[model samples]
Target chain A: MTGNREQLLALRQATVSFQGFVAVDRLDFSVAAGELRCLIGPNGAGKSTTLDLICGKSRITSGEIIFRGEPIHTYREFRMARTGIGRKFQVPSVFRELTVMENLEIGCSREPGVWHNLFRFSGGADTERLERLALLVGLQDELSTQAAHLSHGQTQWLEIALILAQDPALILMDEPTAGMTAHETNMTAELFNRLRGQHTLIVVEHDMGFVRDIAETISVMHQGRLLAQGTADEISEDPGVREAYLGSGGIGHA
Target chain B: MSGKLTRQFLIYGAVCLCILLVPVVVDDAFLLNKYARYLVFGMLAIALSLSWGYAGILNLGQATTFGIGSYCMAMFLKLKTVPVHTGSEGLPDFMVWNNVTELPWIWVPFQSTTFSLLAGILLPALFAALLGWFIFGGRIAGVYAAIITLAVMVVANLIIIDQQSYTGGFNGITDLAEFSFLGIDFDAYSASTYYLVAASLTVTLFLALAVSRSKTGLILQAVRDQEERVRFFGYDVALYKTFVFALSAGIAGLAGMLYTIVMEFASPTFLGVPLSLSIVIWVAVGGRQSLIGAMLGAILVTGVQGALSESEAFLETWTLIMGGLFVLIVLLMPKGLAGAIEALVRRLPQAGNGRSARHTEPDHRPETHPNLGGTQ
Candidate 1:
């Protein structure tokens, strides 16, 4: 329930059908400004699909996605990205051939036109901001290293840093901590905690411990629809979530 | 870093110096003309490197742009020679021979040399932009992109050969009067012509370097590495691809014009599959990743082919020999001559401290410097 805070994004009965199979069905979801919302469910629960629909990667079969009071379901991916939404894929997707510095610079780029970048080179005011973002992601030392050469954990952080480079209004992350070591996962949790209250974030993660650490509110999806929405404790106690997530085994974590 | 940058600068300077001093070393007008044409080929190689190497768009029909540029310039020169030699109502000999009446509407603007010169570059650029837009905008990528481009080029070649009267057919446009501008004659064998080619090449190289070094160039490289990721970062990936494609075509067109000037003819062969594929081979052998390497690759392969043609023993088997050499190069050095040179440079002893020296090893990365970001 949003109090005085403005709703940053609202998905009104969003449905995405692949041929005849529905990946996301009438998924009504909304997040207030600066809210760090987590979406968790069993595999094929349409959690990632919701992020995809929100970011315009998957077309909405029926319904509307409103971001900052404007309908964005019909917008293209790049247009949605330019309109202050940043997405980090489930797998790390930094430009592998480029140096970390170059990667961060591109992330921080304000203008996205061919002509705007033609005459420009690295350095200037954005350099300071890029360096700061690198520091935030613990990639300050590896700025000169190519993304391909970075360690798995570092590469994941580089993607996060890349999203932060734009300082976007909303960040859509799909399993941000997947494949990360526990230590790296904890660090990522810390980073996500720090990022909240400045940027609205929707993280689709299965790492329950990591999720419990940073998630203020959690939304659970089952069979292509939102099954429950509440705090971690509230969701864990819900009988429906217990059946869908564990088939009566109940929430896996204490 | 400064030392490495300085070495790179000196290397580029040395290359330019060597090219400029070629006239002094070779006094024969005929030899100079051959070298000038080879340099034009070098420019074509640079164009390929930009699109294929940096942008990751492998255009199999690069000769389409080159041929278009060649025809544009050839049209003007044909008009000049038509009035002087054939004296046939100010119409190109091919058109007159075909028994057409007045000059076609297209030939009227070519009367002004400036229009022809500009059209030579602009037409190919415009054509590539539209083609690139269609290909990239459709999100057709990788091998499909290559196939589409190759198909378009073959179509272009067929069209040129099919229109016998308008395009001079398979024989091409020839027998041109010496091109003159500002009271200066540009004879194919003249040192002035060689300088013109040389100067044009130098300018082209630096302009390409400037582009490849720009922020857009870095972004293009990024787009090549990951297209979807770049899209999420708010870049119009198709536009960047189109931009580089057009730029590459413009350079190729310029090379085509220079080629026409030196060779004194325009042929359908210029747009044929062989020439287009040959351009790809040159870039592959030279080092697609390095512009200078690609240029040298073109010059080296072209020069060797020329020499082998003159030898009685190798005359018939030169294609075989070149083919074998190409296979060997691809097998032994997939990155081409430039990558080998770069690895060698990194292995050599450095004057700098151990930190900078350690940067050369492929597997090694410098230790994390926590204070590095804070210093600024």
Candidate 2:
């Protein structure tokens, strides 16, 4: 890791407990600006919980989350979004009834209040941005298509485009390529590679191939705690990563 | 977009033209007055559609707002009819009959026509805003919200029925003086009042259409389909819901004031569950998602009921037949009459804009190939 890169987000001793069952124990984690980090773990390893804590989806039991040097653990989900953090759910959640262009336009809305939304008309600048975003996500051809009609990979790309429409500083994606074909996965990897150094991302994924393709540093979580963190190559060879995540399939499998 | 708006305007204009021709075509004053009553009901249906169809809030207590508006207008009219000119106590007959010696502080505000009219609209909207804030602010939705609103209607009815002196009890405020504004008498029996109702309905319909076509309307539907997604996008879901709920309430209030003028009375029945449920039915039968369809649905259903009840053989079984029709509509055309019409329109060769036609379908699509995505 570089020594001088400014920290964009930090979760210091954050914990989440549901009905006396600890989902995420007190744990400290931080990411630098414009860093693309991957979170990998076995089932119930608390990777998603970490993302939830940062996005204010789950209330932290007792800890601090600092975003852009300001503590944000107490903010609501929508407030956190206004502070420039966007999240992509594991299931692609787009407005099924609206067109692809409408979805992007909503994402690009500067003020989404009742009065503003009622009178706000999409200007030429917004249309240009929508077209540019659609092209970037490879959905320019389907701009007028209803989101419900999009294929699984296309929906995933649309969700990505929606998050980018917010122009957020930090993005948390839960399995960005869970149902994509091999080719689609390769394309997603390329998209993420292009996004690197432009936006900070914390992606929770299980596909080792996908992870190795886009990730520089991989953090392995186990039993609600950080088990290991290193380069994909270094983590693949670590004994802790093998015992916790790789299991019987040794590093040779990758 | 302009084409869609033009089509909407043509339909609205046709409806208005028919309404304008009613007095000329129909020789019977009774039938013309009945049609005027239907127009008032149509406004209520449009209000319900704005909330239920567009904003996704199933407001089962809509009539409570209507009742409030009606009572406000009725009180003012009752006050005017009191014989203050003959050196008699300027109290309505109902207040005098109930042995009310002094004017209540609440009734004092209704002395001014302008105050009464503003109260008729603002009171209901304020109540709706407060109730919606408590309900939606808690993030409660769907069935629970419906149950809560239905409960409110029941409570409001009971309160009106219990407060005999103030609310006129079960009989409600009656024998209202003819509504007059700016020295213009709006005789309930004349064509002038009918035109007033028609004009109000037209304005309400246009206002609703404008709101529904705005970007806010798209977001409201999105919130209906995926509320959490909208919240995750940094929009206040509760605030939007409350705004639409209050807007719907205000419209219903206006309709209530019209009902008082058309019927020459306001009763506790206006606040009852039956009327509230009927409003929902009208919107459902019309096409919950279509503003114009809801208005037409109200008129069609009311007209059908009138015709059926007047027949000698079907007099006792009219309600049963209406119930069956509602069930049939729900089962056969879940999207209601408007949805059916929209489907028919889409099939026509000239129905060029696919975007406008798409609003007729169900907003929430069932997840396809659910097993394809890996669980988190």
Candidate 3:
């Protein structure tokens, strides 16, 4: 509520349910511009549901999501995405049959309609941006590789690059390092650090070390409700938090 | 991406050569006419590839669009059998035979081939739009969509067969005069029809290529691979599906117009399920995802049909062979005949890198697309 940058969202008493199964109960949360927030929880803790809510991928059962000071309850996923919100799913999301370059091109493409393959795209500026992004994602050497051929870690970075292509104000990434190796986890942590200030990243991760390395502030959720918010060291040692779940081996063994 | 380009071009060039060379050895007019028919089929296959191959739509009623296009041309041909601009009073002869006092309202547009041409293209497009909008907007765009579209073709065939009084019935529209364009006589069997069609094929291919290269092309390709991701990217997925469906319909209609002239007739049979199914095979056999491959597949399969129709050896089993061939392509070569050729090209070590590089960069760049940014 108190920052030089504006609040990107205002969610009041938000709840999400699927087939009468409530995933997120009545919750209140807000995200400010340039905030590096981490949403962490045990399995089925509704961390993903939160990202889905913010990005409009899933409609709220009952709540108000005032995005950028404007309520967008009726907007669909794409319209909300166009409002400068980008989402990267837990699984790497790219056109597998297409080349890496094609995958990136589609990511940056502003086309709102489906096109039949009756036309071909060629240009200089886009090629330049694609190359720049390729480098950013460490894919310069594999631009021609089909996305299907990418390694798990590389696919994660590619998804990140794809979200970046949208030039969004806030990127909602679900499990950015979910299936990565330790080396990949460390590298991604560094990459997130590099992306910290210029871009606002809301990374939903289970890897406490990765989260601890990248997140400026961490928010823990339990049973669809925020349990606590503090720096990594503060939350790890907090007696109330330890007694709540982590003390009983609830999540993140570390 | 470069590999994709080389694969596409090598196959396309080979197809072009084969098409140009076949007229040399085959001296029979009987055989040549069949080849011409196949060429028209090939055009429709290309249209299928444009939609299903590139855009990831399974259009089970392609023949409906083809029928609309062909029937339009047939109506014009039928009208020409009588005097020019003669209205219901003159009657195109069929009307008289049926003891009709007045011509049907739909027949009025056939007074001019241009109107019929536009109607032919627009009708199928409009139909596709309405059907696609309802189905896609409702978020039922898979096997269900194909089934509903197939139902359309069945209804269309039945309607054509039953409406003999106005439509010439099961026999369809036939006994046409020459197809003249701007005073140029284009009578059936004339070299003009072949030339006109051949030229149009080239032009249609070019236009299709341009579309595939356009910005809309990129988004549609994305949709084909990952519809949800495309939806998440601020695209109206239903509208995109509708656009591609309409585009495929229009292109199919264009091929139908040319086909009517080549066959010199249009029957309810033309609207049957086989015509639609055969087009799908053409695309699948040639390369489901490759446009030129789809056209090549159509031409090749239909050309085989022509040869078999005349040959004593494969008379009863030709249909089986064609069906088996499609199965083989789908099973053994998922990428189709084009993949086979691409393998051959890739085998050449010296010809690899440079060819791929040509198709690489253009695929990656994120730029403002033209015409295709309607949704963007």
Candidate 4:
């Protein structure tokens, strides 16, 4: 987990064009082993599209995405994901009809083929891993509760735990706290601090306070380009970044 | 146990029993046999529930696979009826008229009942795979998938109608050889045929349970809820959809094989839109999310229609009753009969145990709030 961060994932001047519009343009970015990089942007700034490109959920129009130094453009979204780049969606996309434990169990459990999932029995490790992972995510108490009943913040945590259960070295979360109370937001910040040295986390968030607390290096995006990249204070003070975006956000104690 | 769930199960169990006992209770054995046919339809409903109820994929082409199985069964039966002199080519009269001098290559392997049964199941599975690959591969979405399958049903129906010389066309292949499993003849209307139907229904139900309880089932449900999110989670959304689609098709085929034996009739009409349409009704009316509910819906809807259609007062208007019931279930009971029964059972006054109170314990915790698996 601590060795070669640059070799793990690299996007070399990648550009994505949808029709005539460029979503993410010539963005050169990379995630290191155990790096907690926060991606902050105004709405529609392509924070999500960039992650989508690297994961193969959305194809790159040009440029290369190197995974552990191997350019992995050949892999499709699901196939590439199977290689262990676990992702968490902005919306809590869990098996809502299933119980909380069952949702985590599903994340840890991957059937060899699609057909087997339908007929094969659950192995013992799946259940054990789920219980252990639930405890890790602070969900042990609600192991059997139906996911539909979970609170919004609980759902986000469940999604994180699910990604963790996948045991991937890299985790990408979209807007981990778009709508959350200060208490939930503060707790989430604490959770991210613990994730720092263990898993390489790339979070796309709108909450500046939340971002400032967790992100070691914050990358600011404006209109599909990386406008600034540094510590929270550096990006906040950058005049170009402030004028291009963030200027409208009266961002205050209010 | 929760009172609501308990009542739901009890009501369902009671309804199943009544349907099962109808034959023994009725004065006429002939009428009782008809009730058994409706139960075969119930198996399809159960399979539908596995996908639609738990997985949330509404499959409109269940009858397509069911018809495929029936045709395979019919093919074996037709072959058996060939005169001893003509040997393998001893064409069934219909094939002779169609001038099939050589047996269709596809129909050759169905010589043994075991092979025929296997073919009946596998052919639909194979078809589902191809269809799933095309649709779930990401080209089709929502109503488009439904339309493509509906088109398949139409094409199959037209083929069944046009190939009258070979398939018995409009009438479909009939006078099917009675099922003779492992050398035991099922020619008589003994409880044997009924037993076979029951066994198949039970087995299919067991298989569905295994599927729903498995990890694949969870992925399928997840995919249904958020295909893009599931994809983002490193799942190939299309792959899950395709896999579940094939599994459902295979189970539907099993239901069809049993149906052919119970009715001893196989027609293109069985493969047509009407039967496919009826299965949708069975699923929606039974309950969209519960397998047992869907299964019960099929049996109840079919059993009631069969019973009431014969009544002197309502002989011609059973369609109206069935249609009305379908609408009523969809509108008033989004969960279907299973949901309705569960709701009813909640009011039965079980003071000893209350699930809501017990369930709230986890929610009442604070220190465990950040945990993903906790009550969330």
Candidate 5:
């Protein structure tokens, strides 16, 4: 099944256990280059844990995480990011004290070292990229405003823009549309659609409508294991997926 | 931005001019030496601000670095001044008074003025780096980092006191020769020594200001606010913390060396918890977040204490008054005097420009400028 297409990321027999309680069991998952894959699951189903493992946020008990065809489970979180993987937390984690422009500037820093950052200034190209990112994230007007002053939805969008500033090859988003309005959600879906062939995205979303709008493929997780994987239509029609969600009260009737 | 720079220069330039004019105005050598000592303390306050205010590492034991620097310089001066033909073995008086012995191996390298000066800065910086490595690398921060640093300071103070023969015990190393470089003598009581200290303070202040305004400074503040986010941004968070910690320690060490030159002694009291905590008080009152503010806080607080101690009426209550002032400042002006002054400055400009006030109001429009990222 994995024969012809190029794989951007692959997790084989990945396992994560916290004090004897297995958060993520031995699992095998693979993502193709430039694919927009949505991960849908009930709470405690290890959806976020899988993303955490892929991003090196959680230590794996045993398994291999191959990124760009190289094993990367041993990589630290920062190294994982430098290796072209970007993860947006479920909560908005933008720097509250900094201006929106500064937050984006930090993301735009190609060499985020102590000395490099110390000497770095918002130069012509950097400032231009930042302004463009602000515009794309709908934060153009609030560039000079403190991120703490941003609305909840705007904060989420700003974080997305921050990730975009890094220009990573692969992006992992956890519940990116959690608190957004319907219109905002639609716009987010459109943004993801526009980013589709340029960036490989694995979006963990409970918003089935959003998943349907943006996901070319869907993976259903249950009890720390993959229950089903296919297109959104196929996954929604799968009896196993319905049983998993119905048993856990995760999703309303399709 | 230029307005802010002009204001900074105006304020700092005035301070520089005032210090430069001190010897010309104040004829009393005693007052000159006293003021120089206060400026040394001010340098310590700036060092604390770098770590605590800017980097968000509340280093509760900053005096540890200061004491180390003082000891380095004192050791060198003691060796230089000691009689070469002492029957007890050409060592400092305290070592001979404790027991008959040769100079310790560690004291040998400090005999050279150049090595001593370099060691004064490097030793404390290295110590800070080691401590920061363990704490920040382990991802320990906030109050826990403070507790660990305080514990380290306490242990260091006890060790210095316990090693009587080597470290001169509670009395500390004293009777130091005057510091001289390139045939230019800096007599402890002379105006030259005062100028030396004043110049050092100015250099350190500017260095701290430059750091506080740099991109690195921005990232340090970011780390203070959101460590995990910076880590996710592909930065080694520990490296930033350790760098600032070492830099602050090196600055404190430099201040310590100046303190020795001004006071003509290095004592265990320099390493004690009381002095460390007092430095924090100065920074907090001045604005731990502002370098110049912290420096002024130290100078002003020390000057006030000196005045109160000399006055018969307030002599008995000076300590109590200082305690009260610290509490009041913490409660009423948590951002410190600098923050208050900044707020006033910002408000004055906004009051003149009504449109600037309107800029702060939320813009509900969903505007897009596609032309912005054309270069990207």
Candidate 6:
């Protein structure tokens, strides 16, 4: 299905070094429009660091990242977000002091300038969209509750809802279901499946079962480089992937 | 509007009414002048609350902006009084005392009333914007930001004291002619002057309240809660912080100008470390989260300090007593007076209703997502 789709994001030899330690070294990755690609690897495989590079959280030591045909490696974090890339951190990062509705309202705001938001109230359409976004994540009932008061699973869902509120074309999620219960994880997988073709997503996850439930394409990273790219079954059967996860319970056991 | 919002409006209305009616209740000119000064301090406290409480910027140099404003107005007033007070070359007496022949280029702009009035507010605002750009852009926050601001204020105070010729040094700028506008003289001890200060405070209070209720205000609170989260949400967080810092500085500058007018002088103490810390204390004691509460804190604290200091028996001990009181307030009421009242009010309604407070249904939430089951 993704064969005919144009490339939405591309990292051309992207390299990020922290004080001479190459976190992500000369990595090349690409995702087509309307594709849900899962990036899986053991801890410290530079999965999160790759997400950080794309989201402009960490600067690349060399090479370039292009999004929607624009060179985006030079952009700042907020500018990267404005360019239609929404990033969810490994740890849930919703505004704790604000109500869920307020968080959604902020996400739904199209104009990011301070003056533009000074007096502008969210319109009827934006308000409707916020409610819909809240319900999608099963947070409609918790819209008025402070985010700090939310359960960990609920907070994770709220972060998802927040990014969805922005209506971005590309969503990059780092460990979306990290601390979720089995039921919550299944629900998140269901949500990701539904969101597959609507928004291109690059999800970095360690839970192989969760990955199998939703991902249409799987990319494995090892030591800051792409080790394999194929369907879930192909990635599981790859000998290199097995060798990389040798001591760490391999693919199926993960 | 909700019940909470309605109650807030009513409380604000009461505060406004009392502020306007104070002159009517008090016949003594001296007392009115003193209240006027307290109102100016209240305005300064409101400024601090906007930056510290709303934007999460702890500006320890807030008094620098206030002092800058006082000096700006003082320069203009001093130029106006030079001919009458010292009788020489249309230059201020201090310039002659230092043996200076001409007005310095920085002081020359004060010759125009328009420049002086605008400078009194804009100078501090622009200065704050420049400072905020460096601080927030560098991602310096919390206690580090506080230390930087404190250092800036100390440097500013020292410079003013050292430049005795231009700034009137440690003695400051004094003996100014009464400020006149629209054919009315604002004599420091007159009812008109007190009215001006009161009116300015009322306007400042409402303006800050409006800002706190705006969408940007809500976002500012979000920034305060999660700075990194706000960044990923596509907000220029530094810009927001800078905007609020400049606004707070402008408000403080306005208060400073009024302070100079009410006290009939601009002193080095206006922007000194002691005054800056006092402003912070007022905001903390009142309720940092509530604008009106912070303003009232400033007025109440200043009023009590004045009363205590005036009595001969308590003169030397009042400072120690006030310090101890501050410690007690901080230990006992971490949220200040307003937070305590808000908690009490919240409990009263819930206790009376005895119904489930949890909202099971969102007012405008659609029951289902049509697009959820299938890809769009």
Listed per model in order, the count of residue pairs whose N, CA or C atoms clash below 3 Å is 0, 0, 20, 12, 1, 0
lDDT by residue (B1-376, candidate 2, tens digit) is 3344556679888987787778887766677679999999999999999899887899999999999999999999988785543334667766777888888889998989889999999999999999999999998999999999999989999998998888889899988889998777888877888888998898898888778866687778778878988888888889989999999999999999989998999999999888999999999999888888889999999999989999998999999999999999989988799889877775884468656544432222221111100000
Worst 10 residues of 4 chain A by lDDT: A245-254
- Considering summed lDDT, which 10 consecutive residues are worst modelled in model 1 chain A? A245-254
| Model 6 per-residue lDDT tens digits across residues B144-186 | 9999999999999999999998999999999887898889899
CAPRI grade of model 6: medium
Candidate 1 lDDT, B1-376, residue by residue in tens: 2344445557767897899889988999999999998999999999999999888999998999999999999998988874554565567777778987787788789989899999999999999999999999999999999998899999999998888888889899998878788898999998989998899998998888778877788888888888899988889999999999999999999999988999999999998888889999999999887888898899999999999988999989999999999999988887789877877765665644556655544233222211111100
DockQ of each: 0.54, 0.44, 0.43, 0.43, 0.49, 0.53
Instruction: Report the lDDT tens digits of candidate 3 across residue range A5-110.
Output: 7888778989999999888888787778888888886667788998888888888999888888888767987888887788899878888877677777777845
Q: What is the lDDT of residue A161 in candidate 5?
A: 96
Highest lDDT: which candidate? 6
> CA lDDT of A244 in candidate 5?
80
Error of 1 at B348 (Å): 2.0
After superposition on all CA atoms, what RMSD does each candidate show versus the true structure?
A: 3.6, 5.4, 4.4, 4.3, 4.0, 4.2
True contacts kept of each: 0.63, 0.56, 0.56, 0.54, 0.52, 0.61
Tens-digit lDDT string for candidate 6 (A145-171): 778899999999999998998878999
Candidate 4 lDDT over residue span A1-254, tens digit each:
32454556788888899998999988887778779998987777889998787677789888898876677777877667777687887767787766786677667735436655545544344666667777766778787678888888888889888888887778888888867789988988998898887888899988888888898888888778888888888887888777766456632210
Model 3 C-alpha lDDT per residue in residues B1-376, reported as the tens digit of each score: 3334444456555656666555566766555666667778878987888788878889889999899889988898877775454543487766667877776888887887679878878887898888888988888877888898899899989988887788888778877877778888765555555556766776777677667767677677778888988777677778888888888888888888888888888888878898898888888888876677778888888778777866989988987887787787799988789767666665785365766654555454343211221111
In candidate 2 chain A, where is summed lDDT lowest over 10 consecutive residues? A245-254
Relative to the real complex, the DockQ score for model 2 comes to: 0.44
lDDT of 5 by residue, B320-345 (tens): 99999989998988888887787787
Off by over 4 Å in 4: A1-6, A109-112, A115-123, A135-138, A249-254, B1-28, B82-89, B99-102, B345-356, B359-376
> TM-score of predicted model 5?
0.94
- Find the 10 residues in a row with the least total lDDT in model 5 chain B: B367-376
Interface RMSD of each: 6.5, 9.4, 6.6, 5.9, 6.8, 8.7
lDDT of candidate model 4 versus the reference = 0.74
Candidate 2's iRMSD: 9.4
